[model samples]
Target: MLKEKVYAADGDVHPDQQRIYGRGTELMDAEELVSLHVHDGKCILDLYLRKSKEISVLVIGMHGTRHKVAVDIFSTIKQLKKHLYWENNFCLEGKVLMFNGIHLDDSATFSNYNIDDKSVLYALEIPENHMNIKIRISTRDITSVFLSKSETIKNLKLMIRQHTFIPVDQQELTLHDTVLEDNKTLFEYFQDQEDGQILTLSLIHHIRISLTVCINMFKSSDYVVQSVSLLGSDTIEMLTQIVYQRVFILPKQQQLKKNGQILEHSKTLSKSNLTNGDIIFVDILPLCKITINLGEGHKPITVEILPNDTISEVKDHIQKESGILMNNRCLLHEGAVLEDHKSVDDYDIKDGSILFLSQRPPELVTLTFQRTSGEVSELKFNPRDPVSVQSTIQNIIKGENESASKSHVYECKQF
Candidate 1:
């Protein structure tokens, strides 16, 4: 019989102890520290007392230096980290240990990963904590989170789970067309990112996932890509509403295209063949043109407004185009005033409707009244009509405790 001497890091257990080398033995957990080799009520082998061979490992430190160290193959990575820290006076925390791109678990043994004399391990140093990541939803709601640099991508998903209802396993993060692995660190992913910090408050945080989409809008008769963040579950109709907030185009007046195919409004962004950071082309749908006469004698301005837009919103657009303060402007349709809070649909405003852009209670107009006794008096009022100015003045006199009928006769004339 060939028997071997064993020295174990687990007090006498190793990953190799779980190997089913004999048909008579059942597999056991590495942490069980017991290898009952009895089969058919008879013992076959005592492998738990076996010792693994020593292996030389080359460690690539953060500064790019290489150090070869010999250690037992059954030693846990935690023990190796402790030895590295004591020998080189290295950092004891915020370090990510990796072997062949695999994140090494502190509780896992080197032999479990099949490490040999020629194996190389990377020890990367990172910030200890206070790394903030902001996750955003398609609705533009954001959630802000601060995580430890020592944390793994798996930890990141767990952090995301705390803020959103999405499960950790269901969450997928991506960057620049590559899916981020669970074992990777944020420092590895966002090392070059320049996302500056805000006031530690995000509207709601939804982390960067491969599910974001970009918008390409038509501007100046050509397409310009806008870095608009969107979620996969957002429907094309919802996308239109999101786009409308920026472009002022109604959903009905907007058509989206992906891969040169027109995207349906009822379909989700993902169903439209849109992927993370994919450019969704937008074209303004045909809209009804309304004639807005800037002033009494000014040339008519052609404007397209959505039916759902309020008069206040229309005033905002006019302010942008004509450089007029919305509060100082008012719209007149068919000789009736358009209230700011009302919508175009409320007014039944349609295509080719003539809207008069005018000022409210315009600058004072002067009027002179000639009394029968050869006396002249001046009356000033902001009027809707010159013809109503006389009646308005008469009402003002009545309010002042004077009867306009009993007052001396006078003929009014505009100055």
Candidate 2:
């Protein structure tokens, strides 16, 4: 670590001055002094013969990269950092240099640890064997790519395919104008350069598609012709949506038809014999699903109902399956009583809605009948029954008229 040279004597000193026993520096070892260069036909010693100062040590970087550097054995660890930082503009600013698994202090000299020429000092934060690189996909995707020096470009492509959803065959990655080869690694590509400048490559992708068909669709006067394009394998269900978006018509109100024949939604465009530029008419018939909860503890049922089905028809379905009487069934949704005359759509009931079913026992209705002689009679009947009170009174009056006629016949014979 000594910057100043040791003087044998001041001016033209005697050889006896160099051999000043027990009066000068301690003692010099024979192997300590290393021949640096031959200058002016004279030998020059770079390291003085003393302690570990004459030994050179190896420096290792992070990521398993190694650099065999010759450094002053007695030099402080901070001084060794200067040589590394200046070498090819490399940085060791935040790296913790460790010697024999112990962190080397900047203030501590190499001699403090009794280091030798075979000793290795490591910059624990520097990358060496393998590195983590960033990849910028053209789809505005940023992904992390991990690789060792031995990993091939094919492995990298596989990893990219897994993360970015881009097929390896479709991907043609390029760094500047250089197209990467699947057989070679990045280390082989940039082996000459100072450890492959922190890899950040831009990935390019190309997508391929086959045939597409354009169709003409009409919904009443709101017509949209040749505005939608689709593949031949597409279903009529997809066309319904395209018609709705183009013509501002609801999909539920749409029924695709060609030449007066209805097109089933499950059938594909090719299966329906539809070709490019074919015109299809849209019919208005919307259907939806409704859930009927048959009271508590009963499994709910789903019925596919059309716009024409009223609340009474819905009850009929429940009655057929649940055996609950039509009159006893009381259907309600969101606290509003369902009317027999009103359709489910009229109640603003959307598709896949739940309706509660509870029982309402029938009540009796009383009918009073008064005769011309001031005689009164009360007749009771269930209003929900098949026969009405008015019908019962009419039957009773017909019997009375017949009896009066018979009484008139008896009076003609005796009175």
Candidate 3:
């Protein structure tokens, strides 16, 4: 059976203390317990809905406790507080009620709640329509505005424009690839999903002009160029995606720009001011593509590394795929050892440059063990451990034998 270690942190302290939690361990003043079950020889964590039962709910107002009610799956909020006369008892009437963290509507039932297996129910006080959906415009300007999901896209645009000063006409709201219509409600788009889902907004500006542009790839004086028909109304972001698709680049790795200015997805192509037949440079990152030459006979492996990643991370990734240890390998860029602390940009490495990967001399050790049939097995240790020939069983099990002087060598093999 597979065993796994689980860790949890205590949030009550200034510096949060992390602790490994075992199966069936109680958590946070015994409020919850960690449970586990084995599936296909792997331990799976079980923390939800072991059993279900009716739970007591405490409903509160802005002032104080309004009602203490018992609720079950079939019970509705309307049934619990129907007895209170809101016109006379204005204290209880105006005060909005909440269950757990969600604001409760009159139609909201206990079935809507995500209940615990312990039959515990929670209700609290919050302002009316407190549940709000956050809308994010773009990663560059990540200022998020929250409003009720019941609000229409038109109202959402107005709210966002009020804060950003971006004209409502330029705003384009989208969920995945589908565009949100101004008349449609936000809840109508995400009601099928969970409540309070995040909606991404894309801003598009319309302009009128037709231009044919040529995209060229120049590497070591060799060129591969393609011509694309573009409109002034097309967004720079959209053009970036189209160019990347045509160039056979994965969407995530596509970084295209002209001049020194990185293209913003929300801006129109015309705003960047490119007339007909203007040349837009594709390679924005200095060290976008690199070739790692692994000595003689082995074909050179080429990879694309992100600009943000350090030299050490790239080396580690190479080690995983090539079965070469990071400590045993040294990366030489133009005959100089690359430092782990510096980024790829610091070395002035460019696309298609060859980086040499030189390996250190390996250390070998001799291991000897005896089988149940009274036959001795001995061999020089190799890094690639295979079953039957593996060193794990001999190192872990056979190493426990007190006769190390007769069966084991003092030399350690570098893995």
Candidate 4:
């Protein structure tokens, strides 16, 4: 039978007590210790044990050079010291050995022999199973409304460029890295493209408008002047009123220039020459149909009208017939405000043209009450309370009781 042997660090070989291996052969050499790499579970255990001890010294420095070291014992300190010596050539000198940011020892020497410059050291004692893994998360940017003019596109581009996007050809001037040659509309650039590119362009335009509006307001003191200062229907009405005022107040002027000479004091014209006497005489066509969607309470109605009648007149007639007041209502053409003075002459209201007449939602009156012990403790009604039927009933009962008492008194007097 073969006798087992155990090898010690001192180069002395001893027979194993259990007699597990043959005795004639020496126990596995120190090189064999390299084969016994620490497993994940064993490394974890070692980490816990090492952390349990008082960490008096902590060395934080870049990894110098890493070379494998042969050690009989399995420990982080032994491995690290081996690597440290490997870095500085067997001498532990000129290295910072820190404890809580304070240097403990400048030249702490290791007892282990055969340490080399190529050995790697980690005084922090990271687990051998430690691994670095990377993960990625993706997001999307989208917008619904384009609300700014072309002049503000540069600022808008700066605001949205961080989100990873492409700009339309019309917006090329807006981007610092893009170039433009001739004039091109945004729609032209997006034309003949796949749905994805189209959608991206749409999103970019929408984002541009949003960013421009926001930046302009942030930089300017008159944000309210640019944007209507109300929510929902109020905003629409305010915008319409402003448009009406501008159209009515601003004087129309035409520039008359000849032979590179400017003419001053030109007469004001009500209508542009583009539509003046060049008009083709056409019969006043009837409104194919007028479709009205009032948001709530009534089904959409389609009506016909004569082309000679103005949109405001049509709205007034509709208001009278439908019992809908025009004072609080707005006329919308294709979801935009229909100017009160805009002629319906050139533009015919076709059968399918959607005309939306929106009214401001009615103000809500809240009646709040507090209940205690199955009875209302306090009641508050808005817009003042109405005359109650219960109060009238109580008054009638009191009057009847008074009449009965009087009749009884009369009877008593007669007796």
Order of candidates by TM-score, top first? 1, 3, 2, 4
TM-score of each: 0.37, 0.23, 0.28, 0.19
- Return whichever of 1 and 4 wins on lDDT: 1
Predictions in order: lDDT = 0.62, 0.60, 0.54, 0.34
TM-score of 4: 0.19
- TM-score of model 2 (CA atoms): 0.23
lDDT of 3 by residue, 52-112 (tens): 3467655555555345455564455566556334522423344344444343444444544
Candidate 2 local Cα displacement, residue 8, angstroms: 99
Residue range with the least summed lDDT across 10 consecutive positions in model 3: 1-10
Give candidate 1 misplaced runs (Cα > 4 Å): 1-55, 59-76, 82-252, 255-286, 316-327, 361-415
lDDT of 4 by residue, 1-415 (tens): 1111223332332321221212233222111211233234352111001111111222345454333444322234434455557763543343323222221211222211112233333333222222111111112222111212221434334333322233332122322224322344333433343321212222212111100111111333433222222211122223234433543311111122223332232321111111111211111123456677766787776666555557787787677667778875777775566666765553556666777787633333433322222322222222332444345333333444343442221111110
Cα RMSD of predicted structure 3: 23.8
Cα lDDT for residue 12, candidate 4:
34
